[model samples]
Target: AQQQENSEKVAKAQGEQFQSLTQIASGQADIAKLQNQYSSYNIRNGMYTIVAAQSGQVVKAQKAGIGEFVKEGDMIAEIVPDDVKYAVEMFVRPLDLPLLANGQKVRFMFDGFPAIVFSGWPDVSSGTFGGEIVAIESNVSVNGKFRVLVQEDKDDRRWPRQLKIGAGAQGISLLKDVPMWYELWRNVNGFPPDYYQPASGQKNSKTSK
Candidate 1:
């Protein structure tokens, strides 16, 4: 009986040792996995590389100076892609909003190219380029101006190839075709040319009896 008890104790000790070894092996494997995951993050010369999500030209950089500390989710830079198309943004007077519409032709006279003068009438080509009104913001700005977006008009690709972004430009959009008399009357009365007509089912509350 004494010999059997001693043998049993030895077996138990061996089992416990095996369990401890298994646990250690498991911990080592976990550590190796964590190290591999951390290795995937590009760290060179003790500096981590922050890659941009999309490749583009860096238009503006914030906190780019050396030794500048940046937190996660901080905006590091603003990039404008080379291939991305651009549109002209103009602020229009609130009173002039009624005369503008999407798809209307816009005459653009870039400040950079002052020699050119764009005209909405005559459909003639000059140093000036043509654009189409693509969008008009409904909300007025704090300064009582409305934002307008004008894109390059189709079949009228006379825009300068190397135009700088945010270049100041003046634009004028053509209104719908109207008789000369009506235009003169509107101008005389300081009334905005009407481009929108009420729907058949809707009535102007001010005009309705």
Candidate 2:
């Protein structure tokens, strides 16, 4: 009887040891599964890779540096795309506002390409190309100057490939198709041309002699 009791106790102890080892093995597998899930989530969230929406050369870097901290939606850099088209913006003096109009001819000589000068009348000048006035800002700038947009004259000549964007340029636009004497007279008298007409419902006020 004593031998039979000892055998029963030993069997019970062995069963408890096996149960404890099984629980430990299950816990380890659960931990490994959680680690794999976390790694997959990190990859999907782009924690290791960053890609730009469009391909372009970075002109200015705002926050892209090693060991730098950046939040979501923060601007990393300024990129000028390769396919971007260039337009010239010229600031016109307030005094010259009356002489400007859309569709007028414009000539440009960029500082980068100083050897070339674009003129409205190519027959009278060398190295002259062509452009047209596209828009004129209604409001004046802080410096009392108005902005004008000039586009390349596709019908006349194409813009040079060597010309760079954001380059400073000296632009001369042709005034209204009036006589030279009239332009000179207006300049001497300090009179603004009738470029802007009164509204349809408004009447022109004139002092009777």
Candidate 3:
């Protein structure tokens, strides 16, 4: 009878040991869950957005006012992504459109600032990205200048009218900001020639007979 009593005592001690281990494992799982919750709290604390991807003339959106509420994905302001080399676009008429091709080069001069007789697209790290000739409505404008879009780099997106002033000159002449090498090559050769005069507003008007 004493031996049986001792056996019961041993069984009771083993049961208590198993219960203690189970409690320890449960406590460890709780700790893991709390740690995950703490990480999520840190994520909520750090969140922001850049004002604009590129810098240029910035304009406030029409809805933008002091303390105005903005819905998600609503534009807060406008940014002209003028970081890419500027390209002057001109719409060529149907007859003139055929004259233009992927690699057909042209000479361009700025009416306001004409110091440089710029030609062709700017020298890109990628070998001369091609020009795109886009088609628009024929009867849109009274004076037919069909949309002939040409860009050095392909990052060109349509912005507001005022932002694309020099680039929007009409007629067959397209003033594009081409690669640096192309301009230099044109200069070395006699392509643009000496026809271009600097638009410094320094010409003597009185000297003309």
Candidate closest to the true structure, highest lDDT: 1
- Candidate No. with top TM-score: 1
Report the lDDT of model 2 for residue 147. 89
Model 2: residues with Cα > 4 Å off, grouped in runs: 1-45, 114-122, 175-209
Per-residue CA lDDT of candidate 1, range 1-209, in tens? 99999999999999999999999999999999989777755355345566776778888988767888888888988888767677999899976777777877777778767644434353554567789778999999888899999888876866888787988887755556789898899999988666543234665677656
In model 3, the runs with Cα more than 4 Å from the true position are 49-85, 115-146, 151-209
Better of 2 and 3 by lDDT: 2
Per-prediction RMSD in angstroms?
5.8, 7.9, 16.6
Encode model 3's per-residue lDDT on 1-209: one tens digit a residue.
99999999999999999999999999999999999999888775653333566677664455645656667887767766666544555656675454455534433323432233223323321212233443333442556666544444244333233335344332223445557787789878857422222244476676756
Off by over 4 Å in 1: 1-47, 114-125, 175-209
lDDT at 135 for candidate 2?
84
Candidate 2, run of 10 with poorest lDDT: 114-123
lDDT of 2 at 50: 67
- Candidate 3: worst-modelled 10 consecutive residues by lDDT: 121-130
Give candidate 3's error at residue 16 in angstroms: 1.9
**What is the alpha-carbon lDDT for the whole of candidate 1?**
0.77
Candidate 2 global Cα RMSD: 7.9
